[model samples]
Target: MNSHQPDLRAAVRRLGRRHFLTLTAAAAALAFATDLPAARAASVPELDARKIAENPFTLGVASGDPLPESVLLWTRLAPRPLEPDSGLPDKRVVVTWELAHDETFLRIVRGGTATAHPEFDHTLHVEVTGLDPGRPYYYRFRTGTWESPTGRTRTAPAPGTATSRLKLAAVACQAYHHGYFTPYKHLAGEDLDVVFHLGDYLYEYAVDSAGGSRAYTDRVLPAHFNREAMTLADYRLRYALYKSDPDLIAAHAAHPFAVTWDDHETENNYAGDTPENSVPPEEFLLRRAGAYRAYWENQPLRAPQQPKGPDMRLYRRLQFGQLAQFDILDTRQYRSEQAHGDGWQKARPEAEAPSRTITGETQERWLLDGWKDSSATWNVVPQQVTFAQRRDKPTADFKLSMDAWDGYPASRQRILDGAEAAGIKNLMVLDGDAHVGYGFDLKKDFQDPASRTIGTEISTTSVASGRDGADKPANWDDLTQANPHLKYYNGRRGYTVITLGTDRARVDFKTVSGVTKPGGTLTTAASFVTEAGRPGLTPA
Candidate 1:
């Protein structure tokens, strides 16, 4: 491959052999159409299965950010997915989407034609509205007689109504090459209203261990991903590769996902525009813009979340009638540079500085305002990273992970204080990123173990990143002892199933026995519930 061009084979290899198939010459023609001049691109022929090599719906379908009356639907045309241009011609193609009350489309509620723009990597995001609240809908997309798999999505209950309960799953950190996304298979089987993915959706590490600490897989890494994603095309292709997972696709088709990124989406441990490696400010901003754009294009997010250069407005609020208010946060884009340059370290004055914010000024203010305005039975903060303070060692010394909220002491305190001031009775915090799962009681003050408990936190484990992690970490007992607020901890590959009710919120720490191969058995490793108006977990 030439130094200037991306390695298409490497992009396909990221999906591994199980999910991706080599495309035929006809399909390859579509992908390489980018090599043609702009005038020739306009004259590209229509796609036909007999003329093409593979199915364009290789990436499947997804829905997200569901409102009471509207939902965002997504699909990408990837006949030759591993190809540099997803086997799509260098022009916009028309895609027809249909939403109905039945899976058969017999009762079409909404139907429209949308363009799959080559500018956005041939991905389609159709925002369908005017649907009744709290109703389940089936949607599908098609072009040239080829149809996408039907996806199921539910609109949120009408706001201000007295909703009784909500079922949600919080999942994150699925490194495609690390292992199978078996957890998503289980997540798909669950009855969840919505899914929250707290970042590391796709790791930017190269296929080789030399690029980062990620486990090297047998599959070859693309030259573009051999280091870190730097260009818009690189990030877009990376997202396409990860979206090829059948399990991941099924999960997305099953439920709407509210996503937020932690590190590894662009580069490992990237803090805002400051990359882990010493890339120049302008270069890093360009890379961030690419990453953000690719993320929005691939996911079923709305147009409002589109990236403006390096900046994207991701932190927003979603209401579930009177049952819950989800304050989906973007912790990565706004956070100040990781104090002490990232990783676990002894607490420093700078780490706790009031100005060292993780959510930035605008987003933090938005979150605080959401808390104040919320009138739902449960106020849930769906975010990345642990919310409660965690001491790494068992000793009396103060050592916390600089990568988490523990590093932004003042910011965390403000959130906790805001929750209290808002008279939040059932403040539930949902987060992911520590491949290991954790259950914690949100503390009003972490310095005092006996301080008033402000809420409950359910930190989900990785979808597969840890591979087949042990049932428990080596120092599990010590860590739990060191942090009294932490109720449970498990080192496993899975997600958390949460049931929020008017009287209580129950959480089942669902763990997969393994991820090295497909078909891992999912079992509830632990169950706990926090009663309404009272904080802290009790045996469910």
Candidate 2:
């Protein structure tokens, strides 16, 4: 063979075995589609198969942020609805959406159609704008003869529209195998303007990690997912399974969700390139790229969140008129490793080591700048994990999880100091990931009892993670007693409903009996209020 021809053959071989397999699969698919159902079999009428198969919007329709003139409409067109788990073939469906002033959609304001391609799981995100702000609207989608359920949504108040009040429900940590999402069902019923999911919307762990434990008994999941999610298909299945939950669906249909992801969205204790399982560098990048792509495909986020390789830009700002400005941060992607031995091991006292960061340099600056420049009365830091420093102090034997902000003490203090220095009063940090609810004064230092409180931090418990329950250890009581800065602590599974106004913001901790039980009741377990400029939490 000629040298050039030999090189061409080598090049083809270098395309990798997986690529070759994919080509074979594609060819097989084409052959199968052509051979079967050129027309339907006599057993099933060709017309019926043709007719039924035409309807594409099988997963249902959802709309977020219903402005007076525009709304964000989402739908996944499933050509094979019954075989929901199956990937879409080479097919395209046209999704027609309409927004109306009323639920009946009698007065349609905006109407358009977009093509949903199989590559995107036939999902379409139509962010329609040009409507009035701070108004409720109803929307739905149509594909062929099928129609999705109409969803209700409301837009943000026009920028700087000095609103008197706004209600937002904050929640996070929904482990699929842990329990039912009845808490979401309750939240869907609540009268709220917006919902904020701090992080851990889905766990990356396999089913067996949960084991056949207390709450995992009745849990149902996709047949696969025995390993950590690494492929786009794996992520899609994970999301599909989560979205199938009635409560989760209800909540999405009920209110717009402002979301961020914690470690579990990609991998446990994941910090940029370092994953908990120690994925090899190149392999980890590939996995991250896949995970990020799938996340963008499923979430109702704006286009900016579309991932580029392994990175998805999740940190952004959401405004609720002049009442509040929510600064959502991605804490997992830019952080140092957790301290070993329960995270109590202090970093080496050297400048470089103690200076290890959680938010990285750029994100830290962004957060601080956003806080400083905000004009809203309530500056809400919608972040993942507890902001207060965990004391593993005199007893070096005791250690806290290094995965959290506590592990980066210097960085945490810098954030607190930045807010204080910027004169950004009324700072409220809403966090999740501890699987336990906590109320703390965001102080310069938690180790020092006399540290000045700069703001308030409310760490909401998980929605369905098994770590949350009514049971509390006696040691928890001892910890609270020792730490006066910690006002309250609970291991209940629930969320926080926050109501913000000009003078004060109230956070109501809504607790659920248990996540394993479907349709569990929710009640306000505790409530805290922060007066404007007070910068500290007061009992509501």
TM-score of each: 0.89, 0.85
lDDT (tens digit, per residue) of candidate 2 on 1-540: 000001212322455435423434323322232222123233322122235445554455565533334556777765443243333454455667888899888899899987665556667889988988998878888766678777778888888798999998889999877887878888888898888888888887775533323244454444565566666567766776677667887888888777788878787777767766654554554566567766777777777776655666788888777888888888887787665633445544431265678888899899888877888888888899887865543354545546777677778878878888877888889999888888888776666768777788889889888644874644586657656788878888888888988998887888887776565778888888988877677888
| Candidate 1 Cα outliers beyond 4 Å, as residue runs | 1-53, 208-227
Residue pairs in candidate 2 whose N, alpha carbon or C atoms collide under 3 angstroms:
66-154, 66-155, 68-132, 69-131, 69-132
lDDT to native, each model: 0.81, 0.71
Clashing pairs in 1: 10-222, 31-87
Clashes found in each candidate (C-alpha, N, C closer than 3 A)? 2, 5
Candidate 1 lDDT over 449-520, as tens digits, reads: 898988999999998787789986897887888899989999989999999898989999999988887678
Candidate 2 lDDT (Cα, 0 to 1): 0.71
Q: Which whole-number lDDT from 0 to 100 does residue 98 have in model 1?
A: 96
Choose the strongest candidate by lDDT: 1
